[model samples]
Target: MNKHIVIVGGGYVGMYTALRLQRKLGKELRNRSVRITVIDPNSYMTYQPFLPEAAAGNLSPRHVVAPLRRVLPKATILNGMVTKVDHANKKVTFVPGEGEPREIPYDLIVMAAGSISRTLPIPGLTDIGIGFKTVGEAIALRNRVLHQLDVAESTDDVEVRRRALTFVVVGAGFAGVEALAELEDMAKDSTRYYRNIKPSDVRWVLVEATNRVLPEVGPEMGKWTLEQLRERGIEVKLDTRLESATGGHVVLSDGTEFDAETLVWTAGVKPSPVVTEGDLPLDERGRIKTTTQLTVAGTKDAFAAGDLAGVPDVTNPGQYCAPNAQHAVRQAKVLGDNIVRTLHGQQLVEYRHKYVGSVAGLGLHQGVANVYGVKLRGLAAWFMHRTYHLSRVPTLNRKVRVVADWTLALFFKRETVSLGEMEHPRDEFRAAVASNRR
Candidate 1:
């Protein structure tokens, strides 16, 4: 019997796991012994860590994502969402981009659906706030910041100018910090082209409910990061929460209120809500429960990893592995091999590895890193940050393209052009039709 495997989600875990299986089960896959399928809403696997650089125009957004068809030619790529997963029936209801939903049967299932931006019920947040998790959001933010500068420069209204120049980012985690730092730096540099704006006029505020930034990098580095941002004139408001952002009126829990044209929400992420339909055992956090071996606990022919999987940490008892790209990429290797081993009746190997620490870019020519018990800061950390992520960008094609982008940066200025119309390509056509009628 041919063993068919369906992998859901085409992000880090899904792409890498299928790549491993493509390499390990090449013979089985070719001879009809095994089949692989990957399903995702987007056709590409985004390297999320570089999103800040992409947004800052330091790296092209295209280089940070690997197209699913180009990366995994051997596997069946489904460009759509998985609407339902009935493990008992060995089928999942797949919905394509422009078609009705249909069921797909498989001998085994791998849930790598990943996560979504965790949001709050804060007033007007949904209307004004944007999350920084996708390539689209990153580029949109770049354009949005630059457009705000344009608005501020061309306006005479004090309130309009103030709101346009003020940018607020909530959350001080790696995502929020890097985003704030990179965008702030980019916007400051962008002031050279504007006649009325100075770098000082642009107010960048970072609000975090926690007391420090980059908690993953340790308290000392976090403290240092705070000092550095303050030195750059970035308002790092710790122990403060965003109470409301109605109509771009940002109201902080500390009894402060301000109007800002841009609000980026990067507080945290929760598992993709699609997992709720899978009928699998989920932890309190709504992640699929999995063993260290990467198999869904107490279930056969089922597996999970990445942000959506609750895999227990062997090194730290009573704790689950952190849902970061570090663990997701590593766990993918074990998952692919274990699936192959199960088919061959071999003993499954455990997925165990101590975390290697973290590195974060604080914008151009600046960064902080904690790796293997060693701390690095400033330009050295920045270089390490680029080198580390450059190595992990996936595929030689993408790596070379990313390196080329960095190399080009050394000789040329960063592109600050804003193409906001990309979001609404039909707006001009609608206006043309209205003019024709007039």
Candidate 2:
């Protein structure tokens, strides 16, 4: 049988699962007996854990993403979105980067569409609130932060300076804390070049609706992390909600008000809404329901394992595995093996791995980690954070480039210039045209 398998995403699961299958089914693939096609909006798999470094100029944005075509040489890669999956018909409506949507048939499917940033309806948020989910957002925030500094330096108005220097980040999860910390580090380092702007002038604030940050590391570590943040002159507002941000004017649940030119929303994430567009069974959380063995519940030739799939945690009874990269990476291994097992008429292996704890970097040479009940803080944890992720980032090319970035950082200060034109390359050209016409 010329088996065609279409993977609905090229993220952590979709990419890794395809990689594993390519290894296990080499003969079958070479014989033209098995085929794999991976679809995604971008032609790459972004290693999100490195996004903070990318934003802070510690690593290049391109280094954090693995081009799908380069990594999956044996598989078909489509740059597009899967609008709908009619599993009953064994087909999915595929929309390319451009052009009309068309239905593609497949004998098997892997749902790994992943999650998206979960944002609330806060005023002025649509205009001012920036997200911290993608590499592009990271680059944009970096540029905007640096550009704000230039505006502050050029103007003598205290109010304008205050607005430009004040930065607010919502959500105290790993993303929020890391992003605020890394950007603050970059901004403070950038002050040496500005004769007027000092590191003391910049205000970094973190708001969390929940009472704690880094909950994945447990309460004690969470408390320690909070303490570390506060010690760095970073404001940590717990149990505080963002009431509004109209016109860059932030109003918090605790009645705190400020004009922050930069407001980053890293609040949380929900499973990709595309999950609802498919016929797969989903749990109450709107994630595809799958067995511990990584197969979709009550379905054959259909599989899912990622942030969008509700995989059971056999290690912890009555609980589903958390939506995280740690679990997603490991699940992909089992997911690929199970698919191969199914094709070979072998028994499917169940996925059951205990939680390995968590890690987060707080700027340079600072971090916190809780691994196997061993709590580490300061530089030790920072090293662990880098070591763990370096091993996790796909491909030797990316790993080498990341290491090169870190090596160069040791010998030189970060490049602090803001290329604001990256956001609008044609603005200057348009202005030139208007001038010529006049």
Candidate 3:
């Protein structure tokens, strides 16, 4: 009988784990006979850090994601969502697109399905709030922002113009801050082409519920970031919450009411809900409870990592590993090695990594960084942000393309064209049919 390994999700953890396992167990396990399979809805892994830049036209969106099939040629990549995990039966059930649910048995399982955006039941949010997690969402937002400008320029109605020119972003973490900065930068640059619109005509607001923004870099740096964003004409409303956003009308808890056609939701993320279907022990936050070795607690032959796993941070006793790319990448390596070690009857290694600080891009030629106890701001921090993420982006092919995009940007202007029609391709046809009937 051959041993089979099934890895779920093709994000950082899943992709890296499969890659490491293939390399480690290749020649050594030829006679032993082992097979590896990876399951994910999409066959590509998105480099999330560059998503904001992609949305802002700083980097090509295509370059921010790597095809999983190309990266894991040795592993069987299946396009599907694992719906259920039957730990007792040693089989997992998955439902691929438009197909009946299927089941497969495996000797070892690695649960790496990452997280989904945490959402609240806010009015109109479900209909209007745009997510900033995946490549598709980022590109959609870019098109939307550009389209809004077009609407603002062409409209004669003041109300329509005001709504179109107003942009609201929630949250102030890396995702929110980078997205706010990049889009604001793009919108400001794009205003040059809109005869009726200027940078001042656009209302850019960043609402953070916390007392400060960019808290990942610490308090002092966060305060500095607040000043930088405010100086750029973005209204920073801290200690505020969005009460409602209905029909383009925004009602903030801080007694602010406005209308904006663009509403971005980058608040935070919760672990993937798939883990709850299984009988595995989970933390209070719905993440898989894992030992420091990255193995599922009280379960043999089961492992978990990435945003979905609550692996204790051995370096920071009471805290679990933060759900960030840095921790996920490093944890994936340890998780893969431990899996191989477990199979070979070797000692399992515990995951322990120190905090390396944080870096964020405020816009082109602007950023903030706190690495190794040293804080950098302005152009230097911005440069550090690009340099760090560029090196971290997986695959040589993607790295080259991203670099080329930046190099080209130095000599050329950012692309300002918006393809809003992409969102509703059938609108014109529907209108044409209705007119003929009339």
Task: List lDDT for all candidates, in order.
Answer: 0.94, 0.93, 0.92
* 118-228 per-residue lDDT for model 2 (tens digits): 888788887678999899999999999999999999998999999999999999988998999899999999999999998899899999999999998889989999998
Local accuracy of candidate 3 as per-residue lDDT tens digits, 1-438: 478899988999999999899789886446558788899999899999999999999899889999998998778888988988998888899888777888989999999999999988889886568999999899999999999898888889999999898899999999999999999999999999978888999989999998999989999899999999999999999999999998888999999998888889999999898899887789898899999999999998999999999999898889999899999899889988998998888999999899899999999999999999999999999999999999999889999999999999999999999987887899999999999999
Stretches of candidate 2 above 4 Å error?
Answer: none
Candidate 3 Cα outliers beyond 4 Å, as residue runs: 28-32, 426-438
Cα TM-score per model = 0.99, 0.98, 0.97
Instruction: Count clashing residue pairs per candidate.
Output: 0, 0, 0
Write down the TM-score for model 2: 0.98
Q: Across residues 258-277, which tens digit of lDDT does each residue of candidate 1 receive?
A: 99989999999999987898
Model 2 error, position 329 (Å): 0.5
Q: State the TM-score for model 1.
A: 0.99
Per-candidate Cα RMSD to the true structure, in Å, reads: 0.7, 0.9, 1.6
lDDT of 3: 0.92
**What is the Cα-based lDDT of residue 60 in candidate 1?**
93
Which 10-residue span in candidate 2 carries the lowest summed lDDT? 119-128
